[model samples]
Target: MIDPVIERPRLTRYARGGGCACKIPPGELEQLVAQVSNRVGPAVDPVAPLLVGLDGGGDDAAVVELDEQRALVTTADFFSPVVDDPYDWGRIAAANALSDVYAMGGRPLTAVNLLGWPRESLPMELAAEVLAGGASVAHSAGCHVAGGHSVDDAEPKYGMSVVGLVDPHRMLRADAAKPGLPLTLTKPLGIGVLNTMHKATGVVFAEAVDTMATLNRDASAAAVATGVRAATDVTGFGLLGHLHKLARASEVTAVIDRSAVPFLDDARAAAEDGHVSGGSRRNLEWVTPHVDFGGTGELDRLLLADAQTSGGLLVVGELPGYPIIGETTGFSGHSIIIR
Candidate 1:
């Protein structure tokens, strides 16, 4: 438990960008990847065939076929603080990192911490709290927190590198979406705007924090059990951005029912009050060309594209307890249509 006597430092202040919002913009990242892929050329019959890597719209993790029944999934993710509380920030970051494995319909086996801290500015005790938080969550997920690496840096950062296992035949892919399938979202939107508001005003939004910290384990299990093949977590890119990626990769167009989409209670209020993050705005701008926002206001559009941290899985098929936000259709010149 955090001590009541000692005043906690605002960790977000140390970060130039919070959470996954710190990620390189998707548009720019694609260009860099294209150039690198061109030079690397194609692998010619490797020992273990690569099931998924930096291809097919950049799936959640790199999955390599281990055998007929199993494949190995590996992914690494880290980001600066998103909340003022170090422990909560740690939990949120861990969940976000583990989410990559879950998004690909895999179960986490183990994780190693990746930490960057400024020794001169913050006490080592605070870092311990963060690590403790991560360990606690990983334990709950039944994943081992074996060990990790740390570095001294100007700004503090924390996350993990995770390894998981999945059945090669049952694994999910972003490019597996087919026309006529419903889109199911496991969590609500507006986390980015709420987080932006929290950073600016220091008002705690417990719901948003909980949302980010919540694991996608159950959702992933449901998708795989239901035989849903296409899925991706709603993170840095936001819903519209990720949907566009899935649609483009699957050679289909996603039609989102703006009204059916869910959002946190205060998400709209925060956006209306101009509490949106630059990353969210940038996400909107990046996917604007491919998105047909019919009769949707700018504010609604911004909310839809709000950059998320450890958001939720956007599955390509319906789930019993989740909301069906939209459906996929044959390619119609546009990657996403919001009505």
Candidate 2:
């Protein structure tokens, strides 16, 4: 149980943008990348062939072939606090960082902490709690956490850079999605709005915290075992935004059944209370051109595009226990169609 007395300084107060919502706008990021890629050209390394990189519409991680059967998956993710409790923030950030490896059908081998603390303002004890939380979660995932780098900064930040290994044959790729495959989401949506509410009203949502802190390892293992090949975890971009990236990369159209999508019990209520984040609004606007919302109400659309923090894997193929919220179809001008 969290001690109310010890939680004196609300961590969320220091964060300008909370969790994945702190990420740069997807549209602006893509444009910048496109320009840089055009000027720099493809980065070629003769030593180890890059199996997956930015050229393929930016996957969950950068994978490089290490040998005939194995490949190396590397990714880094960090964000500002999404919750008031430093320990929970650390766990959520660690889970979010490790998720990239799992999303690629890889098992994390090692990780290094990435921390930015306001040494002058926040107490160092809080940072220790945050690191301890991250370490505990990493240990549970069977990933080694070596010493990491820290910097004195204005706003406190935390996450990790993870290295993992995957079987090349069974690896999941965002660009591998194909038409006719069912889209399966392993977790529910609405984390963004709930977090937004929490940051504003100081009401802790236990369900949302658990959802964010839970690792995606089980879902990823299930996907690999089930012969699934295309998947990506939902994060700052939200479901619709991430789905748009997957569809565009695979040259397919994703058809989402709004009724079938799952949500937290109070997600709709939170959204109705105007707890939506600016990043979520930006997500909807960015994907507006590529998505065809068929009679879906504004509230539902906003919920669909609500930016997630440590969200779930949006797999292109079905899993037994998860819900099939949509299916991929041949491209019909638009990349995504919500009905």
Candidate 2 wrongly placed segments (more than 4 Å): 1-7
Which stretches of candidate 1 lie above 4 Å from their native place? Answer: 1-6, 42-45
Instruction: For residues 227-288, write the lDDT of model 1, one tens digit per residue.
Output: 99999999999998889898999999999999999999999999999998888889999999
Clash pairs, model 2 backbone: none
* Cα-based lDDT at residue 234, candidate 1: 97
Residue 128 of model 1, lDDT score: 96
Question: Model 2, poorest ten-residue lDDT window?
Answer: 1-10
Superposing all C-alpha atoms, what RMSD in Å does each candidate have to the true structure? 2.0, 1.9
In model 1, the clashing pairs are none
